[model samples]
Target chain A: MIEVKNLIKEFEGRVVLDDISANFQKGAVNMIIGKSGSGKSVFLKCLVGLIRPTSGEIRYGGRNFLAMKNREMKRLRRDMGMLFQGSALFDSKTVLENVMFPLDVFSRKNQRERRKRAEFCLERVNLLDAADLFPSEISGGMMKRVAIARAIALNPKYLFCDEPNSGLDPKTSQMIDELIQDITRDFNMTSLVVSHDMNSVMNIGDYILFLNEGIKEWEGSKEHIMDSDNDKLNDFVFASDLFKKIKEADAIITGNEANEENRKKLIQRMEEEAKDL
Target chain B: MTITGSLENIGEYALLMKRVLTPPDRMREFFREFFKEMYKLGVNSIWIVVIISFFIGAVIVMQIALNVASPLLPRFTVGAVSREIILLEFSSTIMCLILSGKVGSNVATEIGTMRITEQVDALEIMGINSANYLILPKITAFVAFMPVLVIFSMFLGLYGGYVICYLTGTPPVSTYVYGIQAFFRESFVWYSIIKSMIFGFIIASVAAYYGYSVRGGALDVGRASTDSVVINSILILMTDLVFTQLAMG
Candidate 1:
């Protein structure tokens, strides 16, 4: 589990992340969702130590992550895996070599053992045939899979993905989302994903933290997201026509009559739930 | 760039060098990358170095012979002038200037692209020292192979001069050979070698500093590559002047 307390990040006097606090549960797919420049990326970078927080405390599995020394941080980082939006595979290396790189750096295994482990990782990602191929030759979805394989190559205890499905088509995005969910559960690792894709949010966000203009606008599970009343979050989550219709249908099913007074009351109840949750 | 910006860049470059010189996390992998870089930086550069050095030698011989039209001057002076110029300056300094364009831009572009693509961040996430992993091998390769290239350049340069002298028959083969062998101080060779090694280090490290610190996207990578080549050339020339002053003052 990762716990963030009063996390604030500023850039040259401009606040990118306001005082926000949240917990990412272990063995679950936790998501940070926001619009462009809403501080989701900033929050993710801070969590991963890519960017230092202006002020905050980050505890990883009960240890003070922010106060750890460089060597201690590096030791912790070995158990952490990150997948970038672009997949971030070494273009010069083959898929097999990419997966085996972490092992080469950290593992005491011999050449044959490393090869076997790499092959196993590729097989796990259903990329066994692409083991010899370079990243440039693969499709975007395949590249994500290769990135996933490489991330799990060391059997990391934490997985962080930044916009895992950015350029992918809907079907591929859904597939990638499910893959992340499945891996999180199977490996029992804390998986934190930064994404704006509503499809991913609704599908795989076991826990979601929504930010708007650098502030925590809402926080809840996917099941409760639809019921959220925060106007900022509602504007974002129900911005689509399909979701707006769903909200109308849900209002009717819940026997609220879709009246102004009752609708306002429902939103009020949701706001309360947002605070309590 | 402003004075403050230049100073910041220098400070950052120094910090990057400090990180790069640290002991690598995995020696086996480091050596593997070192060997690969050796092939890329050294073996792949031989033909271009040879071709350029040969032409430079031939040109120096032809130009020197043209200028000394008076019969009062000995023809062997052409051989001596060409030999001194090629050994002391052309093979080390000029060859490095050429490589600053060739190898420096390549190193910068490669690392810059990786930076933009987030491959460097991925390495860091894996608990690897990205600077050491990405740069130390190239530095090692440059330091190891550049001297060999300079030596080869000197040999080919002398051969080119000999060919031109033989073809012109003005200095004659025996007189040119005698001139080349005359007053040959071993210290000049040492100076040339030291200069080449320093040039190689400057090219690799300066290019890498620009490349690894690049931000933004593909355009930034291109800009970094250009910056790397320009900066490397300026630094190499400056270092050449300083080394010459210090070594042969």
Candidate 2:
């Protein structure tokens, strides 16, 4: 489990992450969703030690991540794996070499052992045929798969993915979502994903944290987001006509339009955003 | 930028050096990278060095021989002057300035591109010291190979002079050969070799500093690469002046 308490980050007198507290459970995909410039990336970077928060307590497995010594942080980073939005595979390395990188650096395995492990990771990602191919030789979805294979090569205790579905088509996005969910369950690793894709959120979000302009506006499951009373969350989330129609159809069928008044208010807010744009 | 900002950058550069100089996390991987870098940074550069030094040496000989047109001066003066020019300055200082443009810009663009593309961040996220993993091998490989390049330049340069004397026959080949062997100081060769090694370090490290400091997109990477070459040239000249003064002043 991971815990963040009273986390605050400011840049040049502008607050980016307000005093925020949250917990991410082990073996479940915890999702952080927000509009752009809403501090989702900053919050994720802080958790990964890429950015230092202004003030906070970040505990990973009962250890104070914020206050660990350099050596300790180095040791702990081995247990963390991150998948970048751009896939960030080493352009110079072939697919198999990319997976074997962390193992070569940190594991005491022999040559055959390391190669075998990297091959296993590629096989798991169904990318064994592409082992000899460089990242540039692959498609966007295939690159993301390679990134996933490399990320899980170490069997990290925590897996963090930033916008893993940003540039892919719907079918590939769904496949990636299922893959993330399957790995989290099979490895029982604490997974934290930052995305704005409602398809992913509704399909795989076991837990969700919603940030609106750097503050936690709501936190719950996908079902809860549909009925959430927060005007900003509703306006931003259901801005798509498809999700709104689904919500309306569900209300009509279940006679659970207890928040029908809330829906009208959200429509009004969406209209206001459109006018401003 | 203000003085405070410049000082902050210097501090950051120093800290980055510390990170880069740390021991590798794994020996096998370090050696693998080291050998690859030796080939990339050192072996790949042999042809350019050979071509430039050979032609320049021929030019220096012809220029000096044409200018010493008086019977009052000895016939060997052209060869002696060419030797001094190549050994004392050209092969070491000027050649390195040329290489700074070739190799320095390369290191900067490669690393800066990696920075903007998030490859360096990936290394850091993997618990690898990106500086140590990426820059150290290049630095060591270049530093190790620079003296050999300088030696090659020295011999090739002298041979070019020999060819010029043999072909032109203005100064007799025997006279030029004697002049080449005259006043040949072992210390001058050592000095040039050592200076070239230092130049190698400056070229690699300063380029790396510029690359690692990059934060923007492709345009920023281009700026960094150009900036690295400019700074490397300036630093190489400045260090050359100091080294020459120490050795001959």
Candidate 3:
């Protein structure tokens, strides 16, 4: 489990995270969702110590990450695995080498041991045959798979993924999401994923924190999301025509009623966003 | 703002110093990386350096042979001219110019791409000091390769002079050999080698620093590469002046 307290981050005197705090649980996917520029990525970076919070305390398994010394920080980092938005694979390295890099850096494992472990991770990611291929030779989806394989090579206790499905097609995105969920469950590690993709939010979000322009707007599960009464959350989420149609269908079938004024407000918000789109 | 810039410079220097003092295993990895970089530098860059060195020698010999029409001057003066040109300037500065285009640009582009793609961040997240992992090895490789390249430059420069003298006027072989032997001191060769080593260090560090410092995305990487080349060129020239004054004097 990870506990964050009063996290505040400022870049060039502009506030990105404003006294945000939350708890992330192990054995489940903790998803942070927001529109672009809404501080979800910053929050994720802060938790992982990639970006130092201006004033906050992050407790990972009871240790204060912010106060750790350099050596301690490195030890903590060894326990971390992050998958970046761009998949961030080393271009010059083949997939096998990329997976073995962390082992090369932090472990005393011999060449055979390293190769065996790397092959195992690649197999887990369904990328066994692509081990010898360089990142440039692979597609984006394959690169993301390689990134995931490398991230899990160390069996890290904390996993952070930033926009893991950014450029992927919807079907591939769902596969990636399912893979992450399966990994979190199997490894029983604290998983924090930052994204705004509704499909991802609905699919793998065991717990979700919604943000709007740097403030935490709402937090809940996918089951609670469809009926969430938070005006802003509902507007941003159900604004999609498919979700609106679903909501309308639900109301019609179940004889559930949304007040006339609320229905009008939802339609108006969708129209406004449609105009901009 | 000036203070901020100076402080940043100090911080950069301090970081480099700290990177130098890391644990033995980490330092060894850096040297291993240096070896890899040196292999790339030597193999990839030899043709360019040799070609440029040859031209530089030929150009200098052509000018001296054409202009020094004085019968009173020793015919061996041609080798003296060649020796001075190679030992004093060409071996160090000209080779660096070629390397700045070859090795320096590659370093900038590699690290710049890493920065923009968040591979540097990946390293940092993994608790590996990216500076030690990336920049230190390049610096070490530069220190190792630059001196050898300078020696190559000197040899090529002399060969260029010999070729030019032979092709242009069929000057007596003994005179050219005598010119090379005349007024040649070990100190001059040492000075040139030292200067080249320093030039190599400056070029690698400046290029890597700019590449690592870039933010945003691909455009930032491009800008960093261009800036690294420009800044590294200027720094190499300036360091060359200081190195010559301090070492040759």
The predicted structure with the larger lDDT, 2 or 3, is: 2
Error of 3 at A39 (Å): 0.2
Off by over 4 Å in 3: A259-277, B1-17, B20-28
TM-score of chain A of 1: 0.92
**Model 1, stretches more than 4 Å misplaced?**
A252-255, A259-277
User: Which has the better DockQ: candidate 1, or candidate 2?
Assistant: 2
lDDT of 2 by residue, A171-253 (tens): 99999999999999999999999999888999999999999889999999887998888999999888888888787666656
Residues B1-249 of candidate 1 have per-residue lDDT tens digits of 999999999999999999999998888989999999989888889999999988888888888888976789777888888889999999999999999998999899999999999999999888888999999999999889998999999989988888988898867888888888888888888889989999999999999999999999889999999999999999999999898898888
True contacts kept of each: 0.76, 0.71, 0.82
Candidate 1 C-alpha lDDT tens digits along A158-253: 999999999999999998999999999999999999998888998899999999999999999999898877889989998886787677657756
lDDT of 3 by residue, A1-277 (tens): 9998998899999999888888999999999988899999889888877789999899989999999998898899998999999999998789999999888777788889989999999999999999999999999999988999999999999889999999999888998999999999999989999998888998999999998888888998989988888998988888788887777656555654555555666677779999999
Candidate 2 local lDDT, B94-160, one digit each (tens): 9899889989988999999899888898898888889999999889989999998899899889888
Which residue pairs overlap in candidate 1's backbone? none
- Once fitted onto the true fold, the runs of candidate 2 whose alpha carbons sit more than 4 angstroms away are A256-277
DockQ of each: 0.77, 0.83, 0.74
